[model samples]
Target: MRILALTSWWPEPANNGSRLRIANLLRALAQKHEVHLVSFRQEAVSAQQIQRMLRICASVDVVPQRVWRPQPGEQIVSLWRSEPASVRATWNPEFAARVGERATDARPDVVVAFQIDTAPYALHVARAPRLLEELEVGNIHAHYVNQTSTHRRLRAWLTWRKHASYVQRLLRHFDACTVVSDNEQQLVRRIAPEMEAIHVLPNGADVHGCARDWGSPEPDTLIYPGALTYDANFDAVKYFISEIFPRVRHVRPGVRFVVTGAAPPELRVALPQAEGVHFTGYVDDVRSLIARSWCEVVPLRQGGGTRLKVLEALALGTPVVSTPKGVEGLDLKQDEHVLIAQTPGEFAAATVRLLEEPELRSRLASAGRQIVAQKYDWSSIGQRLVDLVAALAPHTVVQSKRHLPGQISV
Candidate 1:
């Protein structure tokens, strides 16, 4: 089958969660079918990167999209329009026009909008059955942003209402929809009752590469790896440094905390001036650091969707101590695959206990690795997606490939 995927950003520097998900999923889709990617390019992609993508995808089109800063007048106009958000409106015209032209010419079996950000562009792709991959129930994320971030409460609330209505209205036009978890699936169904085929296609990790054997961990070390520029992560690390890490340090003076990921300069400067805390701005690969650490910590107070950071850590045989919110969609059993701790005290205690108990760490790490290997590897997740697309494909387009594996209902 020929599939066209629309993304909000270039799916390279697959260092972040979303890009890694798209890149790996496309690689898997390309195994059995021809996949074409149409992405918004923030900066020019290098020739080397283009060739790399071409190896995985049948074709790749990067549409240059400028980041726009609207004036007060434009903001008022956006409010009056109340269709796409201001940020989304800036790129939609050019993006949708390109997608409309390509879909008309290629006439692919399916047109997949990877996230809600790309839905406007996907809606314009008129030549194929549309599939909207709702990476998160958008309103939930917006609500959390409003609750947690100090910079834009009013804007966040507005975004929340807009996204809730936008999703409900948009899903009705698509053939099928998908989300990262059962919770998100329920939210989508509730918001858009007219949509019948909403699949719970979760995020996955490269278990093989991350799961490779590593030497013994550095003693009393913990790592939290994520894009710190993201509001949730920024809040999390700050919260951890302020409330949680102090308690842990009080108990274990030698404990070392590594905040490893790309971060804004303001955030880098704002990092707590506490002993034993080191901020690694950005590392090319975090697997080695994850492998060398005693455990991974996720103290996120906001955000939706299954966290790829947690999944990657688990894939690398790293025991995790996270809040219930942190591991919300993964359906992980508390104390079985991970140690769940909610408050600062609980989190500190869990970290201290894990630091002292090598056997417990080994047990959780082993269990995590096994669980991810069985259910959350990219191969199985990608196949589930392929099956979903095949099911949604036109009978004339998919009938020729009936011999393929049967669809796995969500």
Candidate 2:
């Protein structure tokens, strides 16, 4: 089967979860079918990187997309517009035109759009069997509206309403839709209850890659690894510092909290002044950090989808202490594969307990690694995706109008 995979981001040396997911899936799909990738090139990718992607995929095409930085006048106009800020930002007429042209020429049996934002372009190929993959319902926006200060909350609420409506309308057009987890699938169904084709395809880890150097640590160092620029991660660190760390310090004063990720300017400025908190802006190899750490911490309060960090830690045989929200969508038992906490006090206590109990930590870590190896490995998860595309391909009808010039369909 010929499959066209669409996404805004693809793995190219950058260690981002979404990119890694796309790259792994494409690689796996390529093994069974003629897979072509049509992705938005937000950043400059080298020829070497392009070649690397081509080696994994049958073909790779990039549509240049500049993230629209709204001017002051445009920002004022956006307030009155029905479109969400993100929709407006990613809206590109030329890019859509190119995508349509490519899809028509490629004439794939199935066209899979990676996220709702990318659905607009993929949906333009009207005659193809379209699959919309929602990594997570724009929970960041929902989180903002629910948790922000009053002034920001009002703005976020307006944005959320508009985006929700937009996403629901877009979702209804797809032949089939997929979410990252059962939790997310349920949420998507709630938003678009009439859409019958929604299904779950949980996030997966590159177990073999993560487990390469799974060794026990000597000291009690807690590591939080993710894109620090993201609001969820920022909030997680803030909550840890302001609420959890103080309590943990009383119990274990010598322990260090290593915050590792790409931090934004605002987050960089608001670093924790506490003695034990070490903010490492970005690390080349996160696995190394995890290997050195006694346990991994995921204090995310407001984010949707299963976290790759948790999976990676589990794959690396590192004990994880995370909030219930952090481990949502995974069949994880508290005090078994991972330790779950809701409150800051609970989180601190969990961390302290894990730090002190080496045998318990090893037991949880070993169980977590086994779970990741058996269920969440990319090889297994990617095969499921390949099968999905193959099963859908036979029922796909290539419309006559699809070949006609100037007729755009998704």
RMSD, each candidate, Å? 5.0, 4.8
TM-score, candidate number 2: 0.89
| Tens-place lDDT digits, model 2, residues 1-410 | 66778887856655777777777777777777666677777677777777777665656677676677766666557777877666878787876876677777777888888877688888788677888875467485556657658888776676666666777888777788888888677767877888888767777888878757546575879999977778888889888888998898898889899988787777767866788888787777778888778889999888777788899889888899999889988888888899999988889999999999989888998999999988899899888887677667777542221211222222
Q: Rate the local accuracy (lDDT) of all candidates.
A: 0.80, 0.78
Quality of model 2 by C-alpha lDDT: 0.78
Q: In candidate 1, which residue ranges exceed 4 Å CA deviation?
A: 68-79, 138-158, 397-410
- Pairs of colliding residues, candidate 2: 123-410, 124-409, 124-410, 125-409, 125-410, 126-409, 126-410
Q: What is the lDDT of residue 325 in candidate 1?
A: 79
Across 293-345, the per-residue lDDT of candidate 1 in tens digits comes to: 99899998788888898888899888999998799889688888999998999
TM-score of each candidate structure, all chains considered together: 0.90, 0.89
